[model samples]
Target: MGNISGAIVMTNLIQVGIDIGGTKMLTIAYQHSKIQARSQISTGKDFTAADAQTEIERFIHTLAAPPDGIGIAIPGLVDRAGVVIACDVLPNLVGWQPAIAFSSICPVKVVNDAQAALMKVVSELKPQTVAAVVMVGTGIGAAIYANGMVLSGANGWAGELGSIPIEGKTLDAQASGAAILAQLGIDANQSNALVGANDITALQSIERAGTSLGMGLAILINLLNPETIVLAGGTLQWRGYLAAAMQSTQRYSLPDLWASCRLEVSQHGGDLVGLGAASIAI
Candidate 1:
């Protein structure tokens, strides 16, 4: 956990953060910016919105103190009304009212997962710096932070980079983990094992996916002119993939923008979304 702000020094307040992903859900309990307890559950085919809420409540029960506030990071586009508008990765969550569902539990704030990740990145940067976060996992998603806040545009669809059209197909179709695995004839269930092995075909496919991801990021850089770009997600774990992505980003981005913007992987690791969501409560 990062350093807690001075505002938290005068009181004993517990905050809960939940990160809802397509394959798993993680809930963390924090007191004075330190982790008190954490829990994880599989978001399998049987998972539902109610399951997520129950898991969150269960994690809260493990904490030493009751939570005063809660924050949830959800995958997909979240409307201003706190409704999950579109979540192709977790179809069951579409139109769900996460905040309302958890309202009785505590004060709650919900954010798009990618936007939450961006918030985590911004928290570590110098104030007022423009930055962007691009996560290439099961799918590709991005969020931009400009001035002092995240740029969630009208309809909350501002950062749906995965859905960006490229060569008559969506960016997700060309660069996501599923897409890469399909291109390499690897079963979705075998992705982790195959990624660990020194398989030539898998490496090549990852490189190709990296190139596609870089192209998409280059467009974002040209438009946003951010000072930094943080790359996260499981797909970036492959060897040589980050180098490929950087090279392609340079190739496609305007020279000045590419030169001025620093591109690096996320520092928060797996705790990114949880931490970001917790920031809302803090």
Candidate 2:
């Protein structure tokens, strides 16, 4: 396996990270920031919590030895106790507790995927910096990091921006990859259709989705006034989405607030969720 030394500081040995997404799952074993093993698999539409556990277990079997700890990042609402509270992207994951299911494997921690993404960048932030990571993937989700700490709030549900109401429908219903794909009469796995789309209807649908996402960003800027907002996720691959989002964010946000906040795309090109989860395991 490929190794990247000193990318992340670790105090433990043989840590494992599993990132479960709507269409795929990625698992990696790390030995002090160096990869020891890795695997990627598709989690089809009907994939359930049990299926996830089975996949995790199977991947662990490939490692040279048992891991000291495991962390799972789910694209949904996870409680403080590392239990899946709710997950709209992977509906069957709701209520799934990986810690309990994998007690025999090692110590396990569960985290919201977007929050886990935030963790990947947390160590690099300047103290007292207000930042947020908004992930626009199968569905939209965000996590806030303020004043040198992640703003998890009372149930680890503070950043459910996707659920925010907008014109009677949730933001996710209007701006997520799934939403855009649905409008184009395609399936979640067919997101490639959005790339280089030249048709007027397809382009318009993408613009609307991007505008909706921008509105959501405006909400974060107007209320939190964060200094930096990092945008991440698979949907960002769409050609015109970012442009539309930038335009709408400027249009909807207060001029002073917008001027102070700098928007960034993640520079960590690897499996960020997996890396973040692995960091938590350490």
Candidate 3:
């Protein structure tokens, strides 16, 4: 749709992307880099590691009952190869190595979900933006860039903006999509039903949430000094009222950094995670 119109396109081979979040598990059928089919499954607090695995297989099964490869976005650390360990919200998967068993399902690739969100934005957006994709869905996470190199930190833990301690608590504790929803005493189902997003109400709701988002971002700007911050994920997409609060909070961040950087909502396609996973596999 922009300058790089022909860079990535769908072909005939079957490709799938699986996103496992605290609230849901999503899978899509893609050829080349375009999504052709998609489905979402409920992943409540009761979801277990085995259940997550099952849903993954089922998502694949629905797409021709078999696929060439499946790429997964798990909320944990993945080694260079694609083994998943260390999960936050997905306690049922705590310490288990997925590659050992999951490879049998298909040629699989796995990565931290936050990294996938970052991949979506970086692969498609303009490089000059110096963007940071902050995902508040399931849990809080971010991916940053300077020129073209995505910040990987000392280990693979660099993008975990959620763990940064603030106000005697981490961002996850005070402003996560789930936590914020809980704070407002709104059940996710109710929010989704009312607003078609994990966070709802609009006009009034967007303003307050945007303030919380800005507060969380102030810490990021102070640390990384990115040029633009892109807000992604289901909750942020669903709510349309938080922009004002975000702007108000931005006023207090490092003046020089804020003055230079741009803060805007994300416009990347949904297939970004899939393409990123494919890029990882390739």
Candidate 4:
């Protein structure tokens, strides 16, 4: 596969991509040619930074030998050098550095979860189109890509659209999965009771959730001008729910910016971080 820069060839190496989110951990094993397979595990509250690292090492023991490069996608701030500054997804990694720790084990590259997702979009958009990614999972995130180059602002927090501060609260606080659950009168601990609990009720959940997403997308469209914005998350699986908000928000943004842009739910799968992590591992 090509490098994040579009033409840089990677070394002949087998790579592993690991995504550590607040609710789950996903791993993907891949060669430059294609993904071998993917795996996922629940990230109960007990899963921590060190535990996540141990999980990766054990996974490596089964695939490639030690000393192989690894890429990590975590929630929170990612510096230009791929160092995680802060993250709430894994409490064990709070202020715990990856370069100093994981690098000691093997050459490790770190990335913000959203940027990692965008990398997969960039890889998938190869040869012609540009891409933008909006991931609305437990929280919301977005990143822009043009010619395989990612646009990260000066503070290294570029893809963060969740904290735009809407009506005395951020979008994440008001409309995240947790927030959606809160609106449904569910407890914080029971937030994900619906991921696989799909039914007619889940369909209603989708439309209700889409209303919040539509409001958020309005802000996104006005700020970032791109050819296409792809939405990725379990929330988008209810296709009608996602499409509703996307179209609803269209009436609120600038004509020029909104005219050329298209809102789409990414079929690229949630393994994006794992896949893109492999792409940039070397």
Candidate 5:
């Protein structure tokens, strides 16, 4: 696949992209497809909309020049006006318009993180090809693209799949990274170490997560009948676990639908959100 930066360029205009998550915030600046600056910072315990604004302002100050426009990818439900309606990790941001706060800096656009990732995926696809992206990080979120546009749905809450009920539990409760860590009784910080050691408990937890995720994918397949589905985010780091996930998808999805769709893991890694946000800005 071609680099995401190759898709959009705004001559000499410098733009900024921000990807905000529960634990960290990443910012990048680019002009004419070349990176001018980049930074990442921890979203400390007292995280709030104000705190995020403060950090963003500080990060921008580090750049040699001000950006012409800014795009933000946030992990929650955002409205068309760029207000955060709800968030699981950043509860204090609910009802806050962080984009408005940044208006003085540049034109701003805010969107759901998963939707932003989907925009990046859609940019790489053949025109009008149906696609979906399922992100498994601290939680699960999905976005669909069809006819060269994102399906935002009514109320802009279309891809909040993590909240969908599955076997009397929410998908996130059974399949998210937090869920897997809880099931394994391991600290979030120690997940890599435990998984790397091939701990049986950790492996079992991942398998369970994969199975739950597969069930969710099956539902999407049955409904959207997408041509491609991309699996992404931090929790899907284990290849064996992903294989199990594919197995569950094959088992639960209709044979015809499963046969017609292709499954892929995101190759963009951490840069996915940043690139997606930048795509919106440019």
Candidate 6:
């Protein structure tokens, strides 16, 4: 499999990428295909868009000089104008217009986090075929690439997978990292709460979340019959969670579709989102 970690140098222009995730925020500066600077900070569940804006401004100033362009990857329904319309995980971001705010500094582009992730790896995907990138972090979001382009519905909200209803509940409420923590009755502010957990309750919580995630994937497979489905995000660190999800996906997905699709784990880790955002800026 092609690795997504190394630099894909294509230009001499300087660009900045900002990834605003449910639990953390990452920022990077790239020039000539190499990262010149990087920064990361924890963002608790209570973190709001206002807090994110402050952090973004601070990170930009820390760069040696202004970048030629900036790209931001964020979770939620972002409109064509880069305004976040709705975000279940970070509801305060609704109506937040980061792109417009930063446009004065440089050309800015804002997109859904999963869409940015798919863009980061579009080169590796089979041409003119359906491919999906699913990120299972604090929330579950996906992006669909078909016919050699990312699919954007009329509202620019084609892949809001996390909010889709299943079994009378939103997928995010049942399958996401936040959902897993909630199932275990753990505090959302506590990081790594599931690591090394071996109790029956913890195991059951993991299984429940994993099953939900698998069901969501099965739905995608049955609907799109994608040639590739790449899974990424911090939650995959839990081996048990991934195992349960795979088993359930295999069980729930149509036999033909399951066999046709190739499931892959992303080689790029925490930096993948930021890199994709940088590419968007380029």
Off by over 4 Å in 4: 1-4, 7-11, 126-130, 146-148, 187-206, 238-240
Per-residue accuracy of model 2 over 98-181 as CA lDDT, tens digit each: 899989979999999888888877666776688899988888899888776778887778888999998898999999988998
For 159-232, candidate 1 gives per-residue lDDT tens digits of 88999988888989988876887687766557657668877777788888888888999999899898999988
The TM-score of candidate 3 is: 0.80
Candidate 5 structure quality by residue, lDDT tens digits, 1-282: 212332344457877888887667888886777667888887633578887788779878988888787889888899889999888867887888866787787889998999878877876787667889888887789988876667888877788889999999999999888788778777666877877888777888888889989999999998999999988787787646687789999999999999999999988887788777877875
Q: Give me the runs in candidate 2 sitting further than 4 Å from their true place.
A: 1-8, 188-191, 194-197
Cα displacement (angstroms), candidate 1, residue 25, comes to 1.2
Model 1 misplaced stretches (Cα beyond 4 Å): 1-12, 44-46, 185-189
Count: clashes, candidate 2: 0
Models ranked on lDDT: 2, 6, 5, 1, 4, 3
TM-score of 5: 0.92
Off by over 4 Å in 3: 1-12, 126-129, 191-209, 237-241, 268-275, 278-281
lDDT of 4 by residue, 38-119 (tens): 6777774467767776777677767754535677887778776766676654556666556666766677888878887777
RMSD (CA, Å), each prediction: 3.6, 4.4, 4.8, 3.7, 3.4, 3.7
Better of 1 and 4 by lDDT: 1
Query: lDDT per prediction?
Result: 0.78, 0.83, 0.66, 0.69, 0.81, 0.82
Candidate 5 yields a Cα-based lDDT of 0.81
Q: Which candidate comes out best when scored by lDDT? A: 2
| Pairs of residues at least 3 apart in sequence or in different chains that clash in candidate 3 | 10-31, 206-241, 206-242, 207-241, 210-242, 210-246, 211-245
Please count the clashing residue pairs in each candidate, in the order shown. 0, 0, 7, 0, 0, 0
Question: Across residues 1-282, which tens digit of lDDT does each residue of candidate 3 receive?
Answer: 012221233456776777777877777777655676788778866777788777766666667556676667877676666656567777776655556656676677777776766665666656655668777776778877667666776666667777877668776766666765766667766666666544334335545555666777887787778777877666666455355547755776988988877776666544445455544432
Q: What is the C-alpha lDDT profile of model 6 across 26-51, one tens digit per residue? A: 99898877889998888766878788
Model 6 is weakest, by summed lDDT over 10 consecutive residues, at: 1-10
Model 4: lowest-lDDT 10 consecutive positions: 1-10
The estimated TM-scores of all candidates read: 0.90, 0.92, 0.80, 0.83, 0.92, 0.91
